[model samples]
Target: MTGKEEPKEVRKYLQQSHDRIFENNKKWAEEMQKKNPAFFKDLSAGQSPEYLWIGCSDSRIPAEAITGLDPGEMFIHRNIANLVCNVDLNVMAVVNYAVRHLKVKHIVVCGHYGCGGVKAAMTPKDMGLLNPWLRNIRDVYRLHQAELDKITDEAKKYDRLVELNVYEQCRNIIKTAAVQQCWAENEYPVVHGWVFGFADGLLKDLKFDHEGQLKEIQKIYDLTKDA
Candidate 1:
């Protein structure tokens, strides 16, 4: 051949990651099968997850792995800062399907302490299209600006914003039509707010729980007659 063979490192660089990823997948599936012969079979039949997890798109925090749950245990939807914007149809669809179809017993809005979205929202520097998405977090800060401004420590302020953002998004879920209908009919699908501490690799519930908070918000937001 006229062309010399490519260098080993160059060839490796040109190769796609499919080989390693598939190898890992094969190993993972085999391990699951070894653990339980019916694991994949049962998962393939259908997913009847009890929870719908609305979490940050950050790779470090996978909804199932961190929660000690199996693949079919939780329905998932992820976005920046785990937002539940009323304008976002993607999240609304997930919630509608989970509450109305899957009948998930819990809906979780999980944010992480070191969320890039939240940090970016707190800054004045514009992030182009991301500015619109991150503005949701900024609105949360505006709602609790007095409380947030008092926290002179920047780190503490960031953490507080993360928690507050979770609470607001969880509230958004509570305000959804599908969730209200499901709660009225099935009396299920409670909403929860939580934060993951990157340092500890633990989930800490923020206690902005739907059951208790619903009564207060019902006066304004509840659409179901009996609820």
Candidate 2:
């Protein structure tokens, strides 16, 4: 192969990853057997993850690793731009299960400042296959276009857009029928907006609380309302 040619060992790399995971799991099982046998056996039965994390599909930001949580701690749903759409069945199913069955107390929408997906959404170019996914981010821009357009600093504008996108996605999650139903019946679960900073590997909460700011949205599913 030429010096500039891309590596053609994608399958080999995948095999290597499988090997590593096997070794890791073996070591983990051995440690668990030695130290915490009962806990391991209980975990084997099933998972009871408490947090539902909706995050970008960036390789850098791993939900489990960032939070330093174990395997069955956080249920995750990842997309290109980390968008929460009402019509997305896959995400909806995860949310339904997490809230209804698992009873997850927190639903976190995590976005990163250096997100390629958000950057693509800010541009006018055709993203081809990613158009539909990024369209949601574009909508966030449209909703706050006046503010975004007035910001002369390009870097600052991009950062603000990323934060805004997270807040909007958090709002979108609360607007879901299942989440609203959860709110109607109980107050256990709460939606939160967070941003992961790639530079420092720190998570900053955007303070977008679904319960406090979006009470009017909950009225849509109020069962007590006269029909």
Candidate 3:
């Protein structure tokens, strides 16, 4: 096969699959409109979402699908492992818009059980460019090394790391200047840590209080007075 050449079945299914996807989308749109005539109209006018979701990019775990929220009800940002990297401008921009512009009341940092990202980070192998990204998770493990090292079972450690990753990302979001500023002024965007269970189709809340934790850790990371 040349640079452009491909198998016949591959080409056939590519078109057929896309055609089916569009067909499904059309039917979905019609069903939505039939249920609510103003569904698209309201969605197109402008988005005023009350929540901003930071979640993993796993296709099996969609933020909207699990939350049972309609489109435009929530502003969403998805990435590998749902990391809230302070250095990543992509998440910062989403937080900025969601907080300053949309005034979203809640921000959910959701990770899933059996996350491949968490599993990869748990191993000792170096994964090239992923090293820099995975380093964030490594840092989380290091911070909680005392607790994690105590867990004997590797599977339990992996799952525990998944929850801890979400907790760390939630803390990262709280550490941001934007979130700090908004939290000071109105406390509109409350950050949360949650884990999705693929086995049972449920989202588990880690139950870490944003304001309370902020108060406890504010001794070190608080920037409200500096601002």
Candidate 4:
């Protein structure tokens, strides 16, 4: 298809999808208002989401839809590969608000097995627009280069890298000042690492528990200060 015709074709499909979503939203809201008027009424006044989901911007894996969660249940932040870069002001602000104010109990760093962003970071190409954003994953690869190089199966190696990226991002969240402060004050908020498999539409836990991991991070920070 020609470039000019592509826009018309895309718009045709998008318009259909948009209209359906609009109808669904209206119906869902009306149903909720009827079934549980008090819940929706309080939600209208303010939101107090209990969980924060950091996920990839991949359209196929929406946090709410995948988890069957209602609005005001989970605060979310999505980027190219659900990265957790310490320097990203946008992600930092979301973390700050979710942990400090919303008082979210669980923070999930979710990556997917066949993540395009992770695949890009595995390559050596200069991604002009996404270079800075993907650098965090690249660093993860660098840190685990020795183990990654030892894996013989190419596909298995890539999968390992994807899991490692999720683990590292989960660790990164624990290092953040807001999360640390939350830990210091209350033990309610726990960070978790997850990987969504596109084939089965299932989320697999990477077994990164926040409580034990935070202690290790604190030790590292303390040792650095001592040095």
For all candidates in order, the CA lDDT equals 0.90, 0.86, 0.89, 0.88
Ranked by lDDT, the better of candidates 1 and 3 is 1
| Poorly placed runs, candidate 4 (over 4 Å) | 1-18, 37-39, 222-227
Number of the top-ranking candidate, with TM-score as the measure? 3
For model 3, how big is the CA root-mean-square deviation? 2.7
TM-score of each: 0.91, 0.87, 0.94, 0.87
lDDT of 4 by residue, 90-209 (tens): 999999899989999999999998899999988899999889888888899899999999999988988999999999988888888778777777875799999999889999999996
Off by over 4 Å in 3: 1-6
Local error of candidate 4 at 162, Å?
A: 1.1
Task: Please write out the lDDT profile of model 1 over residues 14-82, one tens digit for every residue.
Answer: 464547888899999999999999998888899899999999999999889999998889999999889
For model 1, the stretches where C-alpha displacement exceeds 4 angstroms are 1-11, 14-16
**What TM-score would you give candidate 3 relative to the actual structure?**
0.94
Least accurate stretch of 10 residues (summed lDDT) in model 3?
Answer: 1-10
Query: How well is each residue in 37-112 modelled by candidate 3, as lDDT tens digits?
Result: 9989988899889999999899998788888998988999998889999789999999989998899999999999
Q: Which 10-residue window of candidate 2 scores lowest in summed lDDT?
A: 218-227
Question: Could you give me the TM-score of model 4 versus the true structure?
Answer: 0.87
In candidate 3, position 91 carries an lDDT of 93
lDDT of 2 by residue, 107-189 (tens): 99999998999999888999899898889989999999999999999999999999999988887788766677776678868
Rank ordering of all candidates by lDDT, starting from the highest: 1, 3, 4, 2
